[model samples]
Structures are given as C-alpha cells and as structure tokens.
Target chain A: MQLALESNAFFWAIEYLATFCCGLLGGLWAVRKRYDFIAILMTVWLTGLGGGIIRDVLLGIFPPVGVSNKGLVITTLLASCAVAVVYPEVDGLKWTMATLDALALGLYAVNGTQKALMYHTSGMTAVFMGLITAIGGGLIRDVLLNRVPSVIGDSHWYTVPALIGSVLTVFSTRAYARGVLSFTGELVCDLLIVALVVCLRMLSVKFDWKVPGAIKRKQYRF
Target chain B: MQLALESNAFFWAIEYLATFCCGLLGGLWAVRKRYDFIAILMTVWLTGLGGGIIRDVLLGIFPPVGVSNKGLVITTLLASCAVAVVYPEVDGLKWTMATLDALALGLYAVNGTQKALMYHTSGMTAVFMGLITAIGGGLIRDVLLNRVPSVIGDSHWYTVPALIGSVLTVFSTRAYARGVLSFTGELVCDLLIVALVVCLRMLSVKFDWKVPGAIKRKQYRF
Candidate 1:
C-alpha cells in the first residue's frame, strides 16, 4: 500500500511537471504573436493546467486551477519564466511546441485515465475523460486563439489515440483490481498501452492520416 | 408550474442568444486576424459555445456545445459567414464586442445560478458556477491568445459583480419557487436583479474597480 501510494505520488510529479512544460511552450507560442503579457500568462496557465482542471472539475472536484494552489502556481511560473528568458535560444520553437504538445497529450491520456478509474468511473467514462483531458486544453486554447482546434480539424487520429490509450489502461487496471491480472502484468500492460498511443499519434501525423469527418462537402466554389 | 417551466426556458433563450453574440464577435475577430475560412468558423464556434461548455462540463453534465445537434454545425457556419461578410461594413466592432461580452457575463451569471439551483447544488456552488460561466470563455480566449485574462488582470469587480447577479437570481428565484414571492413579484425581482448586475459590471469598468489578488512580487513572479 505504501509503495502504491509512492508510485502514485511520483506519477503526480511527472504529470504536473509535464503540464508546466506544455504551458511554457503554449505561452511562448502566444508571446511570439505579440499578444499582451496578460494573455501570454493566461495562455501558459491554461495550457499548463487546462486538461487536469477539466478532468478534476468534470469529476465534481475542486480543480487546483480554481484553488490557485502553490504547487501548480510555482510549476507554471518556472516554465513561464524559462520561456520568457530562453525563447531566444531555440532554433525551431514551433517544432518544440508541437513535440511538447504530443508529450503532454500522451501523459495526460494515461494519467487522466488512471485517475478516473481510480475514482471508480466506468471504462467508457474513463476513456471519455482521457480524451477530454488530452485535448481539452488545446481545444480551449485554439478556441481562444481563434484557431481551428487541432483535435477537431483534419485530425491525425489525435483524439482516437488518446481514447485507445485510456481504454487499454482501464482494462489492464480493472483486471489487476479484480485480482485477475498480476501486478507485473498490469505494469507491462500500462507501458504497452502508453507506447501504443504515442506511436499511433506519431505515425498518423507522419503519414498524414485522419478520421473522415461526417460530411465532406465542396459545397461552394462559385 | 407550467409558467415556471416557460420562464426557465425564456431565461435559457436569453443565455443562448447572448452566447450567439459572443460567437459572432469571435468570427469577426478571426477575420480581422486573417485566419482561413475554417479557422474563422472555429473561432466563432468557440466564442459561442466556449463559456457554456465550461459551465456544463464543470457542472458534471454533458456539454451542450454539441447538443444543439445538427444546428450546432450549421449555425456556426452561418454565423461565421454572416460576420465575415458584414464585419467590414460594421462600424465600431470593438465597442460591439465589449458590449456583448458584458451582456454575456450577466446572462451567464443568471443562467449558472438557475441551473445549479435546478440541480439542487448548494447556493455557494451556484454563485461560483455563475462567475465561472460568465468569464470562462473570454478567459480561455485570452489564454489561447497568450494575453492576460481580462477579468483576472485589469477588470476589477469583474467576478464580484457576477456573484451579485447570481445571488439575486437564485434568492428571488427560491422565494418564488417556494411561493413566498408571487410570480409577478418574482418576475419584477428577476429583471431588477439582471438590471442591477449589468449596471454594476458596466459601472465597475467605467470606474476602474478591481478584485484583489494575493500579493505577488514580479521579482518573485512568473
């Protein structure tokens, strides 16, 4: 039990730290557009915490964002300052932003699913939460920036990958929780699931893949 | 009882229309930013649906962003095209945007309180929901644009006024629902409440009122 608790804490640290990194990239991206300082900070704050905030809030919990709690505030501040100070040193900020975004999406997918299932939400709900957690911030950010949300646009299976990852995690953990799978089996399963999501996301992007939208109309050409 | 349902539906319409205006501003704003057609459409969609999305998600309900079903997509396209076509001819777009934002805030406050009360949540929760519903979208937008959130940064008494509006809405509403206040009386009360809220919010901006944040030293700041 103690070991499990420690593992969870370690997971939290990685998740929060990843969130901060994502925020830095997001904030720096906005700054490059010469958006006002306040907007920059808010973007960073939103990208950093938006997914977790949605996960927690939708679970009927008080989000750390709402609390403006210390750990969250500090991590974001560090990331924001880093971007402000070091943005000059990066060669391809855009690429870095995209890379961090992918990493953030992967981390949030696994972590969010774990959290939801731990709270005993069903598998379907857990997967939904994972997708929401992975894409929610970006959706919010894109909407705010007035850009086509990456998830909803010509998607490279972005959302579906996250959904798959979360569903896999839930199934593995469900077996372990029910004493059907060994601990080692669950761990391996979790790693494999994460790999699947990350690989699929990368491949889809590399191959220019997409899920077909419900309608494909070239309705206006005149 | 039937009248109460009608009245609630009426308030919901008010909320929906206000959101529509916000969406229209977003579309027009996107055009000014020189976004592609799809991007313009997404921006307007976000503006229209962003706040309410946050409101419902935080309330642990299915987000109605996609709930308008087919109309959600069609209306977004229609509003975007309308704004794109007319924004060029529209004078004082900024003023219109600001006015719509203020109006949205008021309606969100009222709607949030009413919805929460309907769900049987605590009054305090209802007030918090109201404030969040009002500011969540623009805040999300500012963050994505990498600007300081208007409400959190410069707008003093911004969220506070929303709270006042929400309190009035729910309080008078509870009275009417319990038969302590006559239906006609409650109607008068509700309108008075909305008027007061709008007045307070507009007045705060005019007078440079502010919400105090915890002391932050930018020397020690993000």
Candidate 2:
C-alpha cells in the first residue's frame, strides 16, 4: 500500500494542487495585511507548507519537503507575487477562493492521513496528523496575523469535515490492510473521502452552519 | 562534542530549568486569560515544550522529548496546576518572573545552538535553530492568544539576546572543533554565553530598551 501510494501520480497531483491553492490563499492574506514583499513571501510559504512541515517533523522526517522542495518553494513565491500584482481583482473572486480553499483542505486531509498511515502510525495518530496537515498552515497564518484561529474560536464547521475525512481515510486503509477492500477500492475510497470533505465544507459555508457553544450565549465576563 | 553534551548533567539541568520556567510563564498567561483548567494545561504544554518540539522535529528527532519524556510532561502539568492555585500571589512576583524568563531564554538559546551543532549542522543553520528554539514557544503562545508575536511587532529587545547567544555558541563550537579550545573550554563557553544572554536580557528589561521601528511615527493608512 505504501509503495503504491508513493508512486501514484494522482497522489502527487493532489499534493501539488493543494499546495497551490493554499499558497494562493496565503498570498491573499498577506496582501490584505499590507505586508512588505518579503513578509508576503514568507507568509505564503508558511501557509502552503506549514502543515506538511509540522506533520513530517512530528513523524521524524528530516529537512521536511516544505523547506527542501524547490518546486514548492517556487510555487509559494509565485502565488505571493500573483497576489501582490493583482490583489484587488483577485479579492473580488470570493467563490473561486472559497472553492479552492475547500479543495485544498480536503486534499491535505486525505494526503496527511495516508502519509501517516504509510509511516505505520496508529489510526488515532493518523487522524490527528491529517487534521494538522489540513489546517496547520491556516492556523500559523492566523497566528502570525494576530487573529484568533478560526478552528478553535469560530462557530463555522471548519474542522468537522477534515476530521471526518481523516477518520474515513484511516478506516478505508485498515480495510484494505485486512484484504476486505481491493487496491482500486482503496483509491476510490480516498477520492470519495476528499469529495465528501469538500462537499461538507462548501455546504457549511453556503448554509452558514456552525457548531454550538458549550454554554448558552449569555454574556459571561471573566 | 555530541557525546559529551549528551552525558552532561549540567546540560540536563539547563533543559529542565528552561522547561520549568517556560511552563510557568505559559500557565501564568493562560490564567490571565481566564482560561479553563484544560485550556490552561494545553497552553502550558505548548509554551513549555513548543520550542523544543519544533527544534527536534526540524532536527528529525522522533516522538519529540516534549511528549515522550514522562518527566518533562509531569513538570509542565505541575507548573500549570501551580498557576491555577495561586496565580494572584504569583502574579505579584514580577521581578522573579522576569529573571526566570531571562534565564530560560538564555538556556534555550544556548542549548538549541549546541544541539544543532551536535547534529553537524552549519554554523548559520545552528544559529537559526537556536533563535527558533528560544522564541518558538512564546511565538506559539502569542499566536494562540491572537496577539502579534512580540519578536516581530514589539519594540522590546526580546530576540536580541537569543540571536547573540546563538551566534556566540556557533563561534565557540567552531573554535572547539578546530582544536583552539578544550572540551572544558567549550563547556565554559556555553555557560558564558548563557550568562551573557541572561544579563543582556535583564539589562534590556531594566532599561526599557527597544528596537527601533522601520518608519517614524507618522500616520500611514493602508
């Protein structure tokens, strides 16, 4: 399973696509912040590769691909430059941005889980790793910009889809390992999970779905 | 050098002391934010071990000692509990907190550089690693709390000592590698670096020193 996934062209495509989308979003964020050119470049790199770097480091992968991969470095730089050049025009394309963000989230979640599984981590750890890989970049971006991380504080159902997708990936991999699912079946399952996550995220955004707070919203000052 | 440092009781003590001081700072910050018990605990862990975790992961160490070491984990938890129980009393000890924080910064900076050197990294890389190790936890904490990371935005000289200490560590280690210094001299060098960083930090705080901003105080709206 590991070897197959490692050589799969589809997996590589997914990774590249996710990195580009996340990088674009990062660029948009930096433009909005009015950061300098160097800072914008840094932000894009952090946003696009931060999650994978965290996951790889935790998994003991040295010199994480985020820093070592020349292709990824160029992609992030390009994304930042694109934003810097035409931010006002790009900023108006809200739907396009949201769609790309959702796709990146789903792709990252699936890839992170699969990578963790490939490294022989427990199912629980795989799911956790997937969540980190999917959202870690955004978390770092928000932190750098001095904003509350949406995953923890926002009402939107951002984390739910990623969590579900990661769990599904783990389950499908386990099934494949047990010979309960065929090779093609596992691939199909991975695709399905990505699609499911994207749909869930988009639907939540469209419907303004939110997770409820622990207590009823009667103002309680600390 | 790696073997000697690994076996040094003094190195172990420095690591533990840094962890304890950082953990205490984290706990205090969480309490100040009026966070719940669980949040406080998480904050403490992140603040105390976040820098080391990042350093270890970047260095390709698995299951970072931050999470894998039972002793370190227990120490962080205890620090959080202490903050929760007597935050008011502890809060008044400003001088003590500042001193401890300075010491932790020095210890972390020195240790981070030495660890990178031990791993045979270039001097430049070792210095960068040391800076990250000393400030990464506080950066994480600031980000989680939705504040601009002091290292980037504040006027204070927070990062100066760490940077200087890291550079010095690299130079001394290089001297030892070239046979210009003995093992005992290397140890002495490390201690002096730490003391130098601590004093620099403390003096900066005492004198209210600040790093100048790029632009003069003039209203410039984006």
Score every model by TM-score: 0.53, 0.60
Against the hidden true structure, what lDDT does model 2 obtain? 0.79
Model 1, position A220: C-alpha lDDT score: 20
How would you encode candidate 2's per-residue C-alpha lDDT over A69-147 as one tens digit per residue?
7777678868777767666655677788778788889888888898899899999999999999999988877778777
Clashing pairs in 2: none
Residue runs of model 1 more than 4 Å from their true location after superposition: A1-13, A63-69, A88-97, A217-222, B1-222
Model 2, clash count?
0
User: Candidate 2 chain B — worst ten consecutive residues by lDDT sum?
Assistant: B213-222
lDDT of candidate 1 at residue A141, scale 0 to 100: 73
Cα lDDT listed for each candidate: 0.68, 0.79
Model 2 residue runs over 4 Å out of place are A3-5, A37-42, A53-74, A152-154, A212-222, B1-53, B57-114, B120-131, B134-138, B141-146, B154-222
lDDT of 1 at A149: 62
